[model samples]
Target: MCGADRLVKVAFSGLAPLVIEDVVVEGDLIRVRARTPEVAAACPTCGNVSSRVHGFGLRTVADLPVDERRVVVVVRVRRLVCPTRGCRQTFREQVPDVLERYQRRTGRLARVVGSVVRELAGRPGVRVLSALTICLSFNTALRCLLRLPLPPLVVPRVLGVDDFALRRRHRYATVLIDAMTRRRVDVIPSRSADAVEAWLRAHAGVEVVCRDGSGAYAEAVRRALPGAVQVADRWHIWHNLAKAAGKDVAAHSACWAKHGPPLNDGPLARTTRERWHQVHRLLDQGVGLLECARRLNLGLNTVKRYARVAEPERLVRAPKYRPTLVDPYRDHLRRRRAENPATPIPHLFEEIKTLGYSGSFNLLARYITQGRVEADRLAISPRAVARLLLTKPETLTDTQRTRFDELSTACPEMIDLTNMIRGFADLLHPRPENADRLTEWITSAREADLPHLHAFTRGLDFDRAAITAALTLPHHNGGTEGVNTKTKRIMRQMHGRAGFPLLRHRILLD
Candidate 1:
């Protein structure tokens, strides 16, 4: 070693280097007592080198252990004076063991601390660097990462780009996820064309851009990387289709809701239904039914065809009118109900029939029974309601129609208790002006710029008049919403700590 350098090495080594240094060990660590003066050099800017040192600072810096023990050497550092005229240059000089100009810790020690910061702790390497006696913010930690000598980014074959808004609806960022690897490649600040373009240009070999339908991305890809094939993603297509269908169904919900009763099930009901409708047509046509029925080839025996059957009682049976029963059980039912407030229906049926009531046991009981019973608590068979649902107006006589209207009014709350939200959707469609609050409704839809959603909307936007014809239609986003909900649940299970790596993989892969 050179004379000056050798003296310095020996001073720091306790016995010096290039020769044996007597080493001592401490438990779990080593202590090397070095007395070397800090090295000095000229500031090339000033061309001044001085033996007269500026001032020395002491630090007990960690180093590689002499043997197995950790070696921390207490060292003193120095600065040189610039002797050049017109130069404002007294600067701390660089040294072999120490990092950059005027650094306190050696290069090796700083690196060890930085490594510990990265692997052992998630602390930003630069901020942790302060622990090594250097002061820089966590941003400086980024420099350490950058300093690792990054290789050129290898373009993946297929890249997926999607935007996620982090804070509710306000702040958005782009995630450049890898479709093949199913991992996040990087994140960009915005969905802007420039930002996406910059990313594409930086990674040269990208083959396919898989994206949800978005015009912004399309424009960006065209301008930035024209050669890359852009494939429309599935998620957006389905999402938009669902949205359009939902609106269509919502507006026409009532049409679907009221399909149960067709006004024409049995032959009797069908005839009545057609005749009644024909009567309305006559009224609408400004022609009386007698002439119309002649045109329709109907018999005048039909009550509606008879001009003198004006009073409803002439054509229809009076409701609550009892049958002329030859039933044997009638007298017994009369006795039991008169004596008791509650008579079980089955017992009544049995008692009346055994007494040789001629009318059907069910008919006698149904005719005799009287109470304010909840529809659900009704003792009669449910098949009747199902039958009624399929029944047509023609199957029911004028008397039956009167009875039906009375029963319908008896359960007036059914109309109000029906699916109201569904009703609201219908109201948005073809509902009457008075029934709908059209004055207040803003009919325009607020749509997102997503391409899939846009394409889906195009179908609805095309034939809006047809969709609006009925107030009740059946479109549903239940499945899509359900999928998103399930995704959140999986995320929480993965531990509120999953990175984009896990999230991206789970979604695209699945």
Candidate 2:
């Protein structure tokens, strides 16, 4: 092959069906002249063969870059006449693989744009496409994506549904997913039950719906897919229990004050105690939490916590420098133990209680059992006790365990709550005998007279069917949660151009 022919073969080799006739190179632009390789054409309208051409024209089209330079394919297209009777109109021949009619870019170029839009939404996609030297406006890129046909819909047997905030607490949208495949099925505009019901009505065959504890979704499922099994999400159930337990801890604020260390005179401790006292004093005078917070220059939550408790001691924590209850009596206890190595703990406690040992016998027992007392033991608060009960036992440290055991013995209420939390956690990871354990836990909580746990158990009883299915069956809303995360990312990446259709397209297509 000659030098020019070799250049044509090298540059346009990948682009077949359009024979390269001429090649030109300008600064930052590569222009190629090409024509159809076919000698005869079939008339599209009449389905008859035609060799006689009415005219020939040059059509310029953009294509994929060659050697990092922009490529423009100029093709010589022919307009052929239809020979069949009554079909006299002339029609242009089309190179199906190379170009599509009315599209300025090649079919390959459209495919590239489509892929880019699928990966990155409008503005980001435009920037990426521009860097590749195939320039297009943001609007054009989005329009190209919108024109692409949607994937074929397969009705899902197991559907997962969840709601994501469109504008966070203001506007929200619902995302539905195929639970087994973990692929997004559709996105509705709002989280209303009617919207979800309409979607369920449209696509039948949904045997199972895995969703969070949203009343709207529950109602929608009951109305639309009445026969489908609903499985309450494990994460949401745990979350609700946690929130209720937190409220329970907050309600018994007086207990915290009576049990925690006395207020200190240090700057931080003094300020905290003073704020607590001031907020309580104001609230005693019938001041609201918001007004109290504004007056004290503190957060509303802080003010609420302070006002909830009967005294400022509840707000006070053990000071870092201040000696613990064990600290003051440590030397005495040690001296007595050294004097009598075989002394009984009851005799030791009797000796301390007479000498102003206001600390619990449980605390003294732990100190004797551990053989040493650390300063961190003084820092344990009722909130800390609640946290320990809420957390898993395996993750607790030696100090936390000692403190927890002491606190549980001191407060029988805490022991009951701790058992409830642990039993609920066990139910979360259910086994064959979980049903018996659950019934026992429920009966115990009701009889314990703990309002928080009783209310939580009552709520669980209300949703017992769905909650049981969630624990026993292998289905959960984890897939729906994952889809919600993906949907959020798509919306955030879209930036200012977050229209519902574009968000839906990116989610479902990806």
Candidate 3:
């Protein structure tokens, strides 16, 4: 045999039982003409061996690409007759390894398609396969992906579970991961307690469950695994604390507003203080929040916000000024104006133009008319003060530290809130002593006049066991949270067009 023929045989080795006759390239297509070797074939229906040839037939199938060209294999096979009594059926010879029954592509080629579709899933998979000289439609690629099986389920000793949004507020799903290995186990379609309970009941070997402080999840775990130790995620606990602290800061806006920079006396600030007084007057007269909003021509939420502050001074804030060409030349304008209070507008514009001011005369005239030149320093908002209070003291910059200290010590209530936040933050690190510290912290929080922190303590008391375990145990849902982040990327890549089955499949296999 020629070396070329031997090389062709080796190239088509995946089609083992078929003999290569000729390999020819026509334009961009490579066609291989081959024939199945003569051998006895078993009758599939009757399980009898038959070698008698009944008829000759040709079958064409697509194979892997060769040299960036499409490959088509045409094989000649013989139909054999069954020799068994009363079962003289004519059955075609089969090559199970090279090609599947009734499939038009080689098994090896199908596997390659499955892998590409597994990663990219529909039109993207088709585009990638087409680049490799393999033709496939989007639906065909999705079919290949769906054909792939899921990984086998192995219950982990330490399991972590979390929920992620599918459509945010409308749809959500749950993700389970092995906390020890950080491998994703399953993706449940719904975040309801029944769904989670069903999943936990099926996979029974979990000894410890790490999850966020969702009441539904806690209830499901309690019902599904009565003996399993539940550990609340420390990050979620801190997140809940931060939320309550923000509300507490907002409630005491009157106190922190005094320590912030001087408030603007602009028209907006005047309107704000006027509205606050009007809303409080109506509220003080026994009017409902909605009724006060209707009477004052304001939004209900706006009325509620105004009602939260004790004094109208807290409602006055700094004007949000946009940048202007006159900003850089403010000192020049201010100095020149102060030298001669009666200086004409045109003279100031011309003087600053020589110093590189590129704005119009009307802009400068408007800037002076609006009295922006006399604007005071902007006051800090309650939200910003809340963030400053929650941050660690060592991480603050010099300027930030001064501002934090001033606001934190604005009133007795502010001081108490700051201490409470710091005390709760200290319990996040797991140690045996932290459990007792958490109990004491809750007791102290309830004793304070801070209503927001009182609600926070109530939540901690409701899930005290899980909260205690989280404060004293090392188990956490950090891995599960990371997997949820990855799942979000997958959902974005799929463009929200896929259903739960495809998403579940990718989460398990990818």
- Best candidate per TM-score, number? 3
lDDT score for residue 28 of model 1: 64
lDDT of 1 by residue, 1-510 (tens): 499566546434523311223334568665655434444466758666766666766545555434344556655545556777677556655545542554444566557655643332223444445444444455444334334332234567777676754344785556665566544466566888889999888877787676655667767888987886665543343344445433332222222322221211346545655665665566567876677668767775452433322222122211222234623444455567778848787777676567665566556555554331211122221223223322454687786565444333333222221222223343443344612342222122222212222334454344332233222222222232333454454344341232443343333323
Q: Give the C-alpha miss distance for residue 361 in model 3, angstroms.
A: 8.5
Q: Write the per-residue lDDT of candidate 3 for residues 1-510, one digit (tens) a residue.
A: 699777776778888778888888999999988888888988888888889999999999999998899999999988999898788579888888664578789989999998988778888888999999999888777767777888888899999999999888899999999998998888888999999999999988999999998888989999999999999999999999889888878766656664333446768878888898898888879999999988878899888778866677655543334567888887677677778878999998899899999999999997776565544323456678889998989999999998888889988888999999998888888999998898789888887867778878989889999999999999999999998888887887673355788888877878
> What are the lDDT scores of the predictions, listed in order?
0.47, 0.77, 0.84
* lDDT at residue 187 of model 1 (Cα atoms): 58
TM-score of 3: 0.78
Model 1, CA-based lDDT: 0.47
User: Which residue pairs in candidate 3 have backbone atoms (N, alpha carbon, C) closer than 3 angstroms, thus clashing?
Assistant: none
Instruction: Single out the weakest 10-residue window by summed lDDT for candidate 2.
Output: 373-382
For model 1, the superposed segments whose C-alpha errors exceed 4 Å read 1-60, 63-71, 75-151, 165-171, 182-187, 201-203, 255-510
**How many clashes does each candidate structure show, in the order listed?**
33, 0, 0
Best first by lDDT, ranked? 3, 2, 1
